[model samples]
Target: MDNYRPVSFWFDSLDDPVLDLREPPAQVDVAIIGAGFTGLWTAYYLKKKQPRLQIAVFEAETVGFGASGRNGGWCMGTATGIEHMLSVPSLQAEGIRLQQALENTVDEIERVCQAESIDCHFARGGTLNVAGTPEVAKRSQQWVEHLHRLGFKDSEYCWLDQAQSEKRIGLSRNLGAYYTTHCAAIHPGRLVRGLAEVNRALGVQIIEKAPVFNYTRVPDGSLLLSTGRGAVRAEKIIRATEGYTESIQGQQRSMLPLYSMVVATEPLSPEIWQEIGLTRRETFGDGRRVVIYGQRTVDDRLVFGGRAGYYFGSKRRALIPATDKAVKIVEASARELIPALRDPALGETVFSHGWGGLMGVPRHWRPCVTFDERSRIGWAGGYTGEGVGASNLAGRIMCDLVAGEKSDLTTLAWVDDVPRRWEPEPIRWLGVKSIEFFGDRADRREANNQSAGIWGSLFNRFVG
Candidate 1:
């Protein structure tokens, strides 16, 4: 219950030698910044393609310390909605291409673990996207129809009627649901640590706590990445920083660092688990304007997360505890859906962990990847709360770009610039809070209406 101590869950389980690079070398074939999924996967693919290439990764903190380690642990194959992508053609094409590329990321991740013989409790039981209201149910119906039209027959998403949804998810308030077979739940921290171990075994160099201060383009057409302790020069550089891209040269202040928070309950009794009827080990999220997501842990505990509130402040900020009102709302929602958990004798399950981290979001809510051919600098981010599988695909694309390959991965378009710039620091924080407040209100109003109609449109425009 102590903030979901993943270190205890993961560290004792690893069997590989830890590589702690104290200082950067003089030169390398590739230098990657950030050690999350994107950075680690980039190194993984690069090593597979060119085993002799000198690859080095620089991390500001320990590997997986960012969102990669702290995320909700859902590995979904699809990106955002196809309709949302179709509304923007450039992003639409990119979305299609990325979806195709990511079709195997979940499998690939599982394969990597199996090949390495790492046990992270990876399960491909699927995910349930439940509707919290009739309006949301309508949207889910439209989405199912849309996916069928897009030739996604193999997606394995079934339309669960209201009764079926409530019976399956133990949530009576849900109107309907869409079940997708393409998602998997992973121990995020273990996955990251395992990847780091595999990378080191493959001869990839990883340096932790090495914050990159600056980089210079040498006259020889190479990059010299300067860190606080040392420097490393490489022929090509890849920026894999997700929410923390603001620290890199030419990338600073280019991304909006939005915060997301999660809370995990204490392990439940076997009786409670049986009563909940969630034995399939699937993840769940309601289709509300302010969506809430929950998943059953391998250890019989339930983890839930949602928008903490409107945040208008620093990108690297943490979330405060839930207000009494918010806690009551969440607890009541849980009880309403799970009768087994309603008994007072079960005792109150205190939240063991409550933490928040930043994620990058562009104006259009599409993942962006940029390549500078002349400078040999490439970057990718802006997953918009759906980065798990998307980041893996981005990692592969980034490696392809660095290797100068003209593969299908490079066909995706990249946003030339970041979204809107906010006011400096303190003012930006206030603005975030105001936006969050407004967004929450709009979500509630739209959810109460049978048809979002004008109010829904307004909410979409504001968030967009």
Candidate 2:
């Protein structure tokens, strides 16, 4: 248990450390892999829909051990590539429904937390996309306009001038802000842990430390999931292993695991917080090309993230830096955004914890949720580091799909939209590394007031 604390700061800060382990039964009505949010949420909703269904979630590690408990705590009602996905003319109506559904998903999570009596420090103060640069400010203005033109009401997305932006959160540079009321900052550790408790209360068998090696289909049409202990047969199986999809025998190229590192500052004093805003716990980030995000914890800690990379062939055991470049980069960025962090009077280092987690990015960089009626083998994943709220939405969608119920969610564009397999080994590694490298170069070039050059242009086209 003590060793698990080093995995991430959220795990280390968990107040309820007690864990319940169960053995996978001989068979179940539904067998879900991965005990993270997607798997657990799917189980919870499934049992809610059909109380008599015997469902079991098989986890390789303890509950919330994956990205669910180690994320940036921004439960934003958005997904990767959402803007582009919704902008297409044919998808306009469906996009509106999808966007509205995602926004409601945030409220759905809040409702669950309240109804279940989970105190996860959830505050829907919204998100502030700080335009700390003049360049970003113009783009921010254009973005809000684009949203309005796309049929989104002003209440969904609004622009703030430099003064209004600073009033919400004291970000440096002080140009403007792209604000939205569709985001909430919650303690992910508490949310995932609380969900587990609720699942247990609702009769969802959570088998911990049961790593599934691979799966097979029986002659009778049932799915057999093989573990070190034994094979557990089920009528249906759902794959929820987001970034860890590579661990599955034939899924090495299905989802690429992108690594994102994070760091958190010690709880600040009132004086320090006064200098650096975020009184409502609004999640904040800039329009940087490389991407970055930060949230003000309920207890006054600055939990910031966005140092990212991609490994070759999605290796599990990575050779990490001794003095993590992520920590230094985050600390430097945070200090620049909030000068109070650089106060010499606060001692040598204000950063108390540092950690990293993997996000599953599909080849097309869009989230995928599919259920094949014929095979009885369905999977929900490809969140690309933005799965927090999407997972909840996915749980509901997957439930409807598994139960054979039709709704607005089942026919969305992402459903059954399986991304093509990534190119083989060296090509995959080279392409991913190229994107990583060019992304970095683009950010650096912009910071130095230089053009991104041809490489950056090609990188943008490839990523888009």
Candidate 3:
């Protein structure tokens, strides 16, 4: 396990195309802090809407350096949750509107991928929320009932029996599943790289390897972002630095950067594909309290990931560089979910890559997009681990907000939803550590066909 390489298989397999970089413009109409999906998509749509705007994207590493490139790659319309919708009555209407918008965003992603001729292996296979244990299967049924209570039709979300789940996922021990057609799988690294090029083609300047320290409000009412080389002034500044938000001064308590790890097996043979029949390559996860996600890559490899690393004090130690233990846990969970991988004869199932990255979790457990016109500062993030499709939505809404257009996007639930700061020090540390510990125990209990009890309920209320 110590010999495990920490590089992403996607990065290793593909030659990174050079990005068009120029010295950060002395001044620009807009300056974006991070060049991940949110920044790129915001630039892309902003330029598309108003071609004459001067936009510059600053990246500490490169495009998709964070979760954008290193995700399970499910373009799903699940950003808004029922609980978030019901958080308050005033938010209900906006949440419902946001939910519909997110569903449309899934289609918009396909539209953009086709229009740009981006060969990122975009597949329209749905998502299967499977249950590997009886307890989880019961919860899956409850989920279906909950959806029904919310006026959803069976066509939107349907419960599948054990045999049907096995037929779809080829996992022998699956107790049941909840299937939805509103999700797709894509090559994350390829998609984000292509997006950078598309934005560049549209006259967006991308400056890579330029780490942003902080921003200052200039006397002229513009924002100046301080970087290694020099300061770049802009009429508007966008903090698109999702998990890296803490790197900027005064924002450490804004969002929790949690590390999630992944492992990918080498390309399996045709016989192995037949045995592990993900014919449509649907993205999948189970009903455990500890989240795990997986997808069948375009090259016929299983790319699986899970959240097994949790560091307190908002340290985000998991993927600053992934620990060997975290990667091992993810690999083991993948094997546990799909027993076919444990077949001794399939020595070809050796893992070829292991990697980890950070996802931003808000203090209030809700995703948000906010812009303060007075400060000329805006940000869109905190999707937990569900930012792929949501980022596109965020980009569009941010464009509307920055342009001072009072459109429907501005009326969404997440707009200006600034959550409270995380508590100070040892209190914060103890709370987070306890939550993670209970989550692990809940997963084990569910795996043993037992209930998660109060701890699981607490987890759902806190971080679900």
Candidate 4:
């Protein structure tokens, strides 16, 4: 696999045909940069609300070429953790309202997918945060108490004991798990490609391979976007680029791109499936300081991923197919979580695919959706690793913000909440690397039944 580069299994399975616009119109009502979930969903809803408005989505590559196509396909409604939501004292009530709205978004996504006839193998099977270690179990219990105080009912989020957890997903080591009914599993590439088709059918122009170098305010109060090929001016511009935000000029500190690597095993045999089952297709993860996520693919493959490489300072970049070493770590971690998958009797632990992608992490660890009236610019991102469902909500919120319509989605907590810019240069690099190092150490300590020390407490209190 020397020549291997990071390409997601979802994208590999898709044969989504190229349907680039011949050229961007001389001018348009709205010009959106970055054709991932945010751009596609924004265009979809914007066109739905006002059919007469001309909309064009300009992509640096193709639609879903970024994190949209490469994610673990967890259509979870949570863009931030419960603790983060309650952080802002002034918006506590609004934050609760926002949580409810996110649950609604999950339903809305399914409704729209069905309406559009997009067969993305979407299953509302929910998610499980399993706790295999004592430290993780303690944390999981605390999280449940926190959720209960925040008024999440048993139907929405509930605790499952060891027996229940094992019965649900067949992972016996889990002392307990937090189960939520507000998430779904999806074939990300299929969903994004289907949305692109839906947008085109609705008269939205998708311009592929149009990398926007920069944008400037035009004399007439319009925005002029300079692409590698040419320039296009529009009345309003939406910066929907998430992980790729650094590529735009003068915005390097606006968002930090973190690499998440994934590996998927070949479809397990029927006997293996019986022994290690995720029968309901629930998304799974362990309660570790570092993020990890997995799901049972529709075709019976076990696709798992975790946070892997972190670049330093000016070196922040997207690593699509990450180094083989990083990918091996991800695969090994997955097997370690479920011993049956690594059993010698099962033969070689073969992974048919491995890939990586970048996700945007806000300096303050909060997702934001805002549109500036004075600048006629709209944007939404900073989902961390939770963009799958949040992008749909972002699109809906962006539609409301762009139209100057005061609606439920517009008044949400994350709207207009700008995070502080990251510190400059070496400081940023040092800070990020330190966090990653501490996170790995914490995970190791927990696995050994040791305490997480001061680093874990500091991270839990300060970082999301």
Candidate 5:
């Protein structure tokens, strides 16, 4: 097979052309930096809520060239638990509130697509969290219980016993699994392209190939963003640069970028699909140190992804077909769960595309929306690898902030700037690797205990 190319199964059939706003006007009412989900959605909502507001978005590269285009398109509600927000009770409440608000983001996305006539391959078949080992099953059970305590009575999530899970997911090696009906998969690239079209139809200016160098608070209370070709002066500014936030200088440099990678397989034959039995358009992931996530595409291909390599590097270097050891692990895990997958034909399945991108993760995993009243600068980031839905909610909150609406969105506590210190450069380079190493050890030990059935009682005691 040829080396993995950047083939977007999602955008393959879409006819929407890329937006070219290379030269923006001198000023606008609202200026958004970064043209991913956050930037585009922010512009969309701002126009919806305040139609008269002149909005302009500046993208460093082409739109959706960032994580928004290259992520594992699972648009589930909140994935990160409240553990990250327990430190601040107020923020914790807001996190829960935002989580509730976003419970239907997938539905909202579908609604928008249908209304705007955007042809994104949208499916609502839910997702499965497969447990490779007993330890993973134990954790899945605990997570389900946690969701119960959080008052999730929707019956969307159910625990499957070994036999049931094996029959349902075609993964006999799995100890058990937790299934949720709320999650859905989409072609992320196509979704972004459609949203860009919708935004343009609404007269929002999207400038691509226009990298913003810096922004300053003008004496007249408007902020001026200096770009490579030209500058945009706006009444308010929103920073939606998720992983690329670190590239910004000055006070907003506290954010750190985390890289993640994904790989997609060549379309499988009907016989292979019959053997796999994963035909129900569901996404699956096993709870491991280097978590593996995979979903069946509409065209019967399996797209899988996991954590990036040990070092902090660019996507071009870190996430390629040759360097995709993580994808191999996922492919192996797939075979392990489905004994039929051990066939040489299945093992030889070529990956069509492999790519990676960065997402911003704050020391504390809570999402942040801050307002600088003096300069009218607003910012949002720190999605911690779960920004698909959070970014949509963030765009709404950002619009509310711009409109000066004193709703719960503005009341959400913004993360105070922590000391801008990362693990020393060399150490930082080794950070992900270290986590992978230790996290694997912990998971393996837990799996061993669970397989022996001794850990269940212990975990039950802890839960009780």
Candidate 6:
């Protein structure tokens, strides 16, 4: 296999090399700086809105090669820091409205996939936020009640008791779960690669292996995107690099890149699946403060992952081995959650693939979909691991912003809410490390039937 294939199970499964190595064009009306979901979706909507506009997407690697291609494949309806937005009276209404729009975005993705004939293995199985302990169960119920208080219908968010949740998913100690019909499981590789092809058909030029090392406002007022191979000048530049944003010159602290890892099991036998449950293929989560996510593949494989630690200095991974320490941690979590995974009959072989990648989190933990008229630069990202479906919405809003249209998309809270720059150097490193430490300790305390205590409180304040 090539180097990119080892990035994730989804990437490894693709039949094509997905290498679009053509050089970028000299000049264009619009220049996008990544071939991931954000850039591709932005291009898709732009072409749909204005077919005559010239657009080109430049990527550091192949399509979906970053977090878009290597994420846990969760097309969730909720964006990070949304609950925080709901806490304010002024922003609450807009937050609810955003949630509704995200729900529609889920269907929109399926619609686009069907219309474009992209078989990304998209499945609307929803999600089960499982509770492993009585304390967590109580907390989970309180959360559901809070949602109801905020006018969320049961169809949108509801609670399932221990017996009900266990019936749906046979987790080791599942006390209950909060189910939401706003998330889906998908093959990240297929979705991204397909979107790139759709953009091609729409006459959008995509150039891979062309990294935008820097950009500046030229004397002529056009932005100059400089790359190793060449440079391009455009009237508008879209900075769509999510987790890898810092790689460019003069953008070191724009967004923080945090690493997450995953391991997927081989297609299991019917008997093993019976012991495992998740027949509907609903995505699973135990609400660990440390953060864990999983899904059952169309091929009967168990794809599982969780927090893979923050690398010092926000360094990102290219290709990870099956034996990586972070991969082992995720594998252990999978077995701990699902006893079927630890069966003696299954023997030593269980997980088939393991990989890791980065997700961008802003200093304020909010997403940004905005355009600056003066600079003529529009960008969207800071999803904090919610890029799958959120990127679709980002694209639509970006289209409006880039085209100078004053539509609903351009008026959302995030349209002008670019995150603040990350703290510099050792402070940034220490803060990230401390958060991970507290998160893990909090989960451990909860497992022991104690409150998350100071550790949990600290984590909530920092991460939120």
Global CA lDDT of candidate 3, please?
A: 0.82
Local lDDT at 455 for model 5: 36
How much does candidate 4 score in TM-score? 0.95
Candidate 2 wrongly placed segments (more than 4 Å): 318-322, 345-349, 450-456
282-328: candidate 4 lDDT, tens digit per residue: 89998887888999889989889997566776454444553567888
Minimum summed lDDT over a 10-residue window in model 4 is located at: 1-10
Query: Highest TM-score: which candidate?
Result: 6
The most accurate candidate by lDDT is: 6
- Which pairs of residues have clashing backbones in candidate 4? 6-320, 6-321
lDDT of 2: 0.84
Q: Candidate 5 lDDT, tens digit per residue, 89-195?
A: 55556555655666676778778889988765677777778887766787789878766666666477688787777766766657878888777777888778888
Candidate 6 versus truth, CA RMSD in Å, comes to: 1.4
TM-score of 1: 0.87
Model 4 error, position 324 (Å)? 2.3
Error of 3 at 378 (Å): 0.5
User: How many Å off is the CA of 441 in candidate 4?
Assistant: 2.0
Once all C-alphas are superposed, what RMSD does model 3 give against the true structure? 2.8
Please give, for residues 1-464, the per-residue lDDT of candidate 1 as tens digits: 12324422232224432447566788998888889888999999999889999999998767876778767778887664434664465666655555666667788878888998766678887888888777778778887876666666635867888888777776756787888887887777788888888898999989887888778987877788988668788888888887787776665456667766666667888766665656777888877656666778788777666664324443354333444345446555655655666667756555555555567765456677776788788777778677878787778777787777888677765433334544566765665565566556656765676465665675566555
Better of 3 and 4 by TM-score: 4
lDDT of 2 at 229: 57
Per-residue lDDT of model 3, residues 425-447, tens digit only: 88877777788888888888877
lDDT of 2 at 49: 91
Candidate closer to the true structure by TM-score (higher is better), 1 or 5: 1
List model 6 lDDT by residue over 1-464, tens digit each.
24676778897788756576676788999999999999999999999999999999998877888899888888998888788777777888999888888889999999999999999899998999999977789988998998899999998899998889888998898988999989989988899998998999999999988888998988877899898669898989999999899989988899999888889988988877888788888998898888899998999998998974677788776777889988898898888888888887855447889988888888888899888888888778999887899999999999988888898777778888867899998999999989999999999999989988999999988987
- How displaced is residue 124 in candidate 6, in Å? 0.6
